[model samples]
Target: MHPEVAQLIERSHRLGADPTITNYAGGNASCKGAEPDPVTGSDVELLWVKGSGGDLGTLTEAGLAVLRLDRMRALVDVYPGVEREDEMVAAFDFCLHGKGGAAPSIDTAMHGLVDAPHVDHLHPDAGIAFAAAADGEALTKECFGDRVAWVPWRRPGFQLGLDIARIHAEHPEAIGVVLGGHGITAWGATSQECEEHALEIIRACQAYIERNGRPDPFGPVVAGYEPMPPEERRARAAALAPLIRGLASTDRPQVGHYTDSDAVLDFVAREHHPRLAALGTSCPDHFLRTKVRPLVLDLPATAPLAEVEERLRALHAAYRDDYRAYYERYADDATPAMRGADPAIVLVPGVGMFSFGKDKQTARVAGEFYVNAINVMRGAEAISTYRPIEEREKFRIEYWALEEAKLARMPKPKPLATRVAFVTGAGSGIGRAIAERLAAEGACVVVADLNTEAAAEVAKGIGGTDVAVPVSVDVTDEEQVQAALDEAALAFGGVDLVVNNAGLSISRPLLETTTADWDVQHRVMARGSFLVSRAAAAAMIAQGLGGDIIYISSKNGVFAGPNNVAYGAAKADQAHQVRLLAAELGEHGIRVNGINPDGVVRGSGIFASGWGAQRAAVYGVPEEKLGEYYAQRTLLKKEVLPEHVAAAVVALTAGDLAQTTGLHIPVDSGVAAAFLR
Candidate 1:
């Protein structure tokens, strides 16, 4: 058998067991390694082909059947029928009968059309984005433009075989062929060449979508939601100019608008309200990349652009809330096949479509996906039917146990599974107990405090890390915090449990707070929180590892942190940052959250260290009384311990909370959940 075919079968068998490449076991390949394996003496010029029921990524030599190259070429002109195709397949399989129970790949006939020794084929999810389009052929040629050749979708049989032969005869130099609604066929003199061709075809299709047909940034315009007024938009645009330009990643930011008149709006929005969002994309690949819909709105002539912009913000917020609710609903009420990430939709009100991305490339990629989705929606609408995967089936595929297992097994610094955690400031102390408990649960504990020596002693006693490593890091210094996190990453390859345990608590009347104190609080509370989270996020994103970030935020952030101006405001900012990071990086698979533990202690590093104790003394409570006082204030009537908070943190980062992200899980007990308005 050809060595190339041998490798292809070997590769297929390996991946076949993986659920991610589930369902479709079909693929093809050719390689320069197409040499006969010397058995005894006679020359064996047989082709190694992937057999049916084989996964391309996990195959072995035994998984392929050998067919004489000359024989296959001879059959091309024979105008073989289904009977012949079956016989060919059975005969091919028979050749490798002693090798294993493996069968022959379905496209064995087409394999003869290629002269290259190396070849490969697979029905990649991304490749099909363009292949299954209503204008699949036209779009394929337009995007690839002569870089590759294409064949119309034909029923796979004798006629299809003849068509492929004709196309090959015409475009002899073409190294690859893509059949609409089918799969691609790539070949090369060497295995590398064939693989590269496959990669390039995918890249070209993805690149074309990223370039030619992207969606808008703002979102699909909504009813009563018009474009920002010229002056208002200009002003807001300027506000964003600095940040947007920094992240634009282009010579120029292609900022633009899409405001549909009543006619266009009515045309799309007439019968199908929500379904109209899908009309913007042209294919199914878009669904895989950008979800299946966008948002739509109606804009009023008199509404101020600023007001409309504000409403848009509300819309985004509402969408997120609905997303969470939908996930919870599907998960709790009944089985809705496990939905993957709640897909972002194109909002198409008065504003045509608002495309979003961290950079121009991402935005453009997302836009192309959106356009294809629109096409799918439009085509299906023509038939008065447009359906994505059946809900349960979609859920099953999205949340396939195999896929879920694969996602769980994603490469990471370390396998962070089934571990417990301990956080410091246990009890009325929010961050502490989190640290202490996570440690008790098997992790090397991390004790953080302004009392450097005290924390060191705690570390020695807690003994979580080979005995918790004692290190003093002020939350404010980016360098110090980042270095500490780096140390942790290096020490353990990665950190599975984290409790943003260090914080400050100052209850000064907002108006009377001094500027120095305010700035210090901001540096310690808000900026410090940002630095640590940023460092952790970078690490997690790099390895595609998802972990838990339990920000020891106070209930004050959610319930209007009063009296304490600097502390409350800083903590509030921390909470918001958690949400933003969650939304932006969810695709990368990282999750963020805030833990409102109410109160821990006055002498905690945040408030007691430096100004923390002084601030606490002014409130007339000795540092010792701080913990109990806060605990008594809770509705649970039970004290909130650092261990309790730590346990919660551990559960979240562990397998128990696999799909949970962007949550504000309140560990303040039942009391905090019903905090007084």
Candidate 2:
């Protein structure tokens, strides 16, 4: 790789890693270097820029688009002006340097046309504050004088790139320019110089805003909008997340993210919040993720729960109606159809923010982008009135043909995408395998287990909070079960797939099974399944998106076995619960099923906890050979593994068996006694 190109990647990483410098996948960086032409065997200048849909912090060689600078610049002569600038994006492909490393982004022209060795385009809150201000040009001049210039608002495309090139040529002494109602762009003769110039402009703007900014820029907090106490605030957020997620997913299902950060709380509670949010986000990247704006609830956090839910429902309906109208008003013959009328973000006074998307990362990033908008609003209001670009311009960008094309290029979603699964006892054994499998199929999993450390480890291994969250829950305690479900709601909107796998085995004859042993076994297996299923059912019903409930019962539930009286009865209870709930929940589209596996001793938490020794003693076989004994009894002569059970779960939920419910799948490797009659 060229030294300059390597430096460009390093520079992009440094700038992208800081949230204050640029948002996720929001900025682009480029470097111009001479490389040998493959055909001519002569040196040719090439422009290497961050590719479309790539995040800078995690960028690699595959994420940079390589283009021949000469061909890129030659497009200027054929440019059909601003009205036809979008065609330029397609033209960029023709300028590729031996098949571009990555697809060139819309900003490719902006970087290629600029007359500098290195260029950085970023969306820093401080710079956007000036960009979003009503008198942005004057503020830019006030902040950095002639060192950083200002360019008027223009939609990003070939024309805007030309506009910036003109500004750069007109002001040779300027280090960068703040693009009106957008972001900032900087250039330098060297990579280090370019990075330094970008940071200098950003820090300078931040300092100016801080030094000259007024206190309470968002205005004093309103009486009803003051933040709730920490514990109460979190409780409220958890309570509302599912309902909000349901509403947001009206057009299409969305995973949710919750935040009660000081910035969001402060903004939502302030007097000027409604008006500024109504003005919508200023930057294209900001609004693209956040929607045009958020839907803010107009009530206090202390309002009765029922009343709050009622108001939210009404507000959501109005938001959808308004969004549809907005789309209709701006749409022309060539415009892409309105994607969805539902809001991506929702704000409640005193509670903070909830952002939704098709997945957790997207949802989290949407919330982060809204926080950036809040910062921009605060800074702009502190210096001057906040004035974002007009709604028409925002609509143009939001529904751009290029953006639609990009969306079309995205890989098809996984079968379990947008599904949230609550897997109890996911710390180890069959439950852990089930959790991991669900996540791999694209479901967000709540790894609930009594062993908090084990659950945390499993969650971390499955990609941390983005894909799974660990929750400590004693299934026997109804309160803990409820709290675990609440955590699921807060973490990923709500539960739509539930695996009731928490269990224990106490193998003994009826006479030897004391009352204490009987009660303990039933409490953990029968009552535990009941508690988890009941709570999860409520959430799924409320979400109005039908769900799946799988009970990991055992073959002993049906097959008669020696010294298994207590364990068998408890498993029997779970198997019945599956049938009863399946009959009841079908109207609501909730599928309830069961998996029965025999002598899963190898990774079985139940067997490891003394049950295996007792069972082995009863069968007169070595503990290690117990699995072989069980396998010998099976027609398939196979030992049932945890992964086999996990696969059964995937089979039930992954679309093919959508219409099949109230069924018991025996994963006992074809044990005759375990077969369903």
Candidate 3:
């Protein structure tokens, strides 16, 4: 790679990594450098810019769009003006250097047309504060004087690029310009100079705001609007998350993220929150992720839970209706159909914020973007009135043809993409495999286990907080089970899939199976499954999204194996719970099923905990050969592995067996006695 290209990537990373500099996937950087031409064997000037839909912090060579500078500049002559500027994006492909690196973004023209070696376009909260202010031009002049220019609001397109180019050419002494109601753009003769200039402007703007800003910018907190205590706040957030998620997913299912950060809490509890939130986010990137604005739940934080829920439901319905009307008012013959009328963000006085999207990362990012908007609002309102772009302009960007085309280009979602799974005993063995498999198929998993450390390790391996979260729970404790479900709701909206896999085995004859042993086994297996399923059922029902409940029952439940009285009875109880719940939950679209595996000794937590040796002694087979002995009795002569059981779970929930419920699928490698009759 050329030195400048490497430096550009490094520069992008430095700027993108800081939230104060830019948001995730929100900015673009470019460098103009010479590369050897394959055909001509001569150095040709190329513009390598951050590609569309790529995050700068994680950018690589593959994420940069390489375009021939000469061809890119030539498009200016054929530019059809602002009304037809979108056509210029298609023309970028023709300006590609070779096959191009990645798809060029809408801002490609901004970098390519600028008359500088390096250019950086970013959305720093401080800079956008000035841009989003009512008297933004005057504020820009007051803060930076002639060093940074100010341009009036204009949608990103060829015309805006041309506008910035003209500004750059007109003011040779200026380091950058704050685009009105948008973001900041800086350029330099060298990569280092460009990065320095961008930082300088951002830092200066931040300093200016801090030095001159007024106190209580969002206004003083209203009575009863102060944030609740930490524990109580989270508890409230947990209780409301599923209902909020259900409302947000009315048009399409969405994963959720919650934040009770000081910034969100302070903003939400303040007197000006309703007004500023209704004004909506100023930046296109912010509003696109956060919707036009948030749906703020009216009423003080001290309201009764029932009253709060009632208000939220009414508010959500009004939000949807208002969103639909907003779309209808601005839409034209060529506009893309309204994607969905549901709000992506929700705010409650004491409860902070909840943001939703098709996946956890997106949902989390949406909340982050809203926080950025809050920061921008603070700075703007501190110095001057916050004045975002008009709603029509926001609608234009939100429903842009290019954005719709980008959405169309996205790959189809995985089968379990929007679903959240709660897997008990996911620390090891079959439960761990099931958790990992569900995540691979795109479900967000809650790895619940009595072994906290083990559960955390498994969750980390599956992709950390974004894809999986760990919860320590003793399944026998109903309170712990309920808390785990609440954690699931707080972590990813609500539960859509529950795997009752936490179990133990105490193999012994009736005489040897003491009352203590019998009670312990039943308590962990039967009562545990009941507790988890009941709590999860409430969450799923609250979400109003149908869900799946799977039990990892064993062949011992039906096969009546010797020296297994206590264990077999518990398994039998679980198997029956599946049938009974399946019959009951079908109306709510909840499918309850069971997987009966004969003898899963390898990687079996139960076997490792002494059950294997006892069972081996009973069958007169070596402990190590127990799996083989069980397989020998099977028609397929195959040892049932944890992965096999995990696969059975995927089969039941991944849609092919959607209509199949109240079923018991045996994963005992074709054990005749274990077959469900």
Model 1: how far residue 283 lies from native, Å: 4.4
51-112, model 1: which lDDT tens digit per residue?
55444655566556566565566665554564455345444444442353444544666665
**Model 3, range 1-677, lDDT digits (tens) per residue?**
98999999999999999987899999999999998888999999999999999999999999999999999999999998888889999999999998899999999999999999999999999999999999989999998999999999999989889999999999999999999999999999999999999999999999999999998999998999999998899999898898889889999999999999999999988999999999999999999999999999989988999899999899999998999999999999999989999999999888889999999999999999999999999999998999999999999999999999989999999999999999999999999999999999999999999999999999999996999999999999999998999999999998999999999888888888899999999999999999999999988888888899999999888987888899999999999999999999999999999999888989988899999999999999899999999999999999999999999999999999999888889998888877777
Q: Tens digits of per-residue lDDT for model 2 on 632-676?
A: 989999998899999999999999999989999999988887778
Whole-model lDDT, model 1: 0.52
Candidate 3 segments exceeding 4 Å error: none
Q: List the residue pairs that clash in candidate 3.
A: none
* Alpha-carbon RMSD, each predicted model: 15.7, 1.1, 0.9
TM-score of model 3 vs. true structure: 0.99
- Per-candidate TM equals 0.37, 0.98, 0.99
Deviation of model 2 at 145, angstroms: 2.0
lDDT of 2 at 586: 98
Model 1, clash count? 118
lDDT of candidate 3? 0.94
